[model samples]
Target: MKRRNFLSLGSALAGSALYAGAMPGAAAAGRDRLRIGMIGTGMRGQVLLRELVRRDDVEVAALCDIEPIMLGRAVQMVTAAGKPAPATFGENGDGYAYRRMLDSGKLDGVIIATPWEWHAQMAIDAMQAKVPVGCEVVAGVSLQDHWNVLDAQLKTGTPYMLLENVCYRRDVLAVLRMVRSGLFGELVHLQGGYQHDLRAVKFNSGDPTKPYGGGVEFGAKGWSEARWRTEHSVRRNGELYPSHGIGPCAMYTNINRGNRFTRINAFASKAAGLHDYVVRNGGEDHPNARTRFQLGDIVTTTLACDNGETIILQHDTSLPRPYSLGFRVQGTRGLWMDLNRSVHVEGISKPHEWDDARVWFEKYDHPLWRKYGEQAAGAGHGGMDFFVIHAFIEALKENAPMPIDIYDAITWSAITPLSEQSIALGFHTLDFPDFTGGKWRTRKPIFAFDDRY
Candidate 1:
């Protein structure tokens, strides 16, 4: 489809209240089966494909990937599910093969799970093709890339959602309910982070059979994420992956809906984790051990919001540590910390003591989880992946605006580049751009506002 034609169609679709308010059952009179496409059929793409095929309302119409092995595996998965074989792209290793899929007029929507650098341009092309997008984390690598995406969505009026599943995590959602119910009592400060060791994920043998943790190889000599993800550690210094931590925190503080981040400051520890891993796993004589990694072993960023709430986010992926988002939601009355799974209420608990968070989580489990917990079993990421993907497909079928919309996508992603700039300037604070263009003052929180998918 031509860009101009798609823009007109998108504008007309926008006029039909597609981007307005939620209208349950609105799309029942529309299509009975939605046609979906997959881009970057790597490990993450395979997981999403598994969930998509599990649904009766979705048809896996097309698949695209530069890697022939991954693409073939995805096709086999669909056919094994008793669905028709999807049209495949990128057999010849053309990076732009996704453009052909987008222009094929066969896809109602596209789910992107490509490397970090390719996210923005691919999403822009999909939106311009009049296809809704459910994109993976970190919308763009640069600040201007984010603005460009925002401009494309604004101009085309296409639906774009960040496939950030962490926001729907059971305990996170429970804490969100607590915040909204005034249990937190006027939010003050919050903290969350990507504090997991990724040494094994960053290095692997090029052989697909040994997908992870057998050798210290990256870039062209690695498989799956190790092929691309580790290169960022060698070339950049920033909070490269921020959505997993910031998405839920944004919900708690109402970011981009009557609240927005205004400024940010960041700091980074010395770069040693990746190099140490290389030396430990492959010895000092390994070629990768001599490669200078620019990314810090630990990166910390602090953000100030318009509503006086403060947020601290840490990016600590290269070190040795158990996985944790290290969430701490504090307010006037009390606080909840995920690190120890404990909560403290000024009067609810014994003075200066902790209560097991499990009781609180059970008492206030998210309504959506309570309703779909059984169905979500076996879905990735503790079944939160089911919720995020469900929200995308349901919104498409209902013709409603996405729960986590374009503004939310860029707002969370812009943190990476902004943090890099902050760290470059010796931990100096920088102004956070308002991607909503002043609409944040009036925009309302729609994420997980109801139990409906």
Candidate 2:
């Protein structure tokens, strides 16, 4: 895992094609339907399973998870959808059971919904096994993990897509259309962040009936995300979950396509929210109250781009607040802010007055949404999940490049480690790694370029 010079490595590897074409066993090669596999059947994994089962073009070929209860629940879901029971693994506490599923030679592609730490290794294993991968957010924990995953894909020529659904959000896509069409004019500064209250999610009771709140427990006593996600908050002080915020922003600026993040500096506020929540909800004398959390209540990171646009991101999950990504896209002529759902233009809007963004969003709604809005309904995360999954399937079926390719995946996920490095060094600005090997200068924008995907 020694750090290799990406600039030189990218230069050496730049000539090779990076498109995600059909693999040897892909459905694109004469198969009637896709044979897919599921890696984790937890709460989030179940949501993905529901979406997969509903797709007529896909079959849940295999399932894996350490918890049998979750595995049973997922089995019930597939059966309820009328799909055949998929081969199940991980029931015997084998952490590497997923590797067996990948080696089974029954999968066309795999969707990884496992915990964050497992994402990198599973993806690497899938690529090495020549299985196409649609992995959930934060591709890897360390910067080297990103490089390793990228290297695996380059060596094996396997398709890998980061299931970053926020990039397909209705308003976010609409703004993307606007940005491409010059509605926002020349892009200047943009802001987005994961600024939602997750105090309850960070500490959930193990009770099945009351899974989210009603208790202050984590690790063995916690449920779902509480079991693992809270551990990161307790050990790290950076933008732990940044893809939701940076994904759409990267799309707007064409990050890792024609532009790239050059450098970044991050600042973190003193830690207080998690402990305060425990004291207020669970008594101060609660055993968990004594646990120290390292994650800041609010972490702000500023990134400079090679294209002259500056991006700011904030991570604020421990505090109490209504959910909002805090998205703001500004340019020389106009700006859009998701916090207030308002937009302002130099001439289209009144003199320095804000206009309802709904009008503009409706006018420029992405073709993909306009065409598949009905189909996307009821899918998780306000229906964006359907689009992300659809993109993966369609790309694999067509043997075309992924809309969100490996370069984009690593660049977006690299923010977490880079932000951590910056904060650990007294908010020092650090040069961003060029994961694309300087190929970005010629890479054209494909994400949401049309409704076909």
The top-ranked prediction according to lDDT is 1
Tens-digit per-residue lDDT, 1-453, candidate 2: 011222232233322322323245544454457999999999898888888999999999999999888899999999999999999999999999999999988899999999999999999999999899999998999989999999999999998999999988999988877876677677889999999898888787777656687788988899888888899999999988888999888877877766889999999999999999888889989998999999999999999988788999999999889999999999878999999999998888999799999999989887789889999999999998898899888877867678788988999998999999999999999999999898887775554435765
Q: Which model scores highest in TM-score?
A: 1
Whole-structure CA lDDT of model 2: 0.86
Writing each residue's lDDT as its tens digit, candidate 1 over 67-121 gives 9999999999999999999999999999999999999988899999999899999
Q: What TM-score against the true fold does each predicted structure earn?
A: 0.94, 0.93
Instruction: Return the number of clashes found in candidate 1.
Output: 0
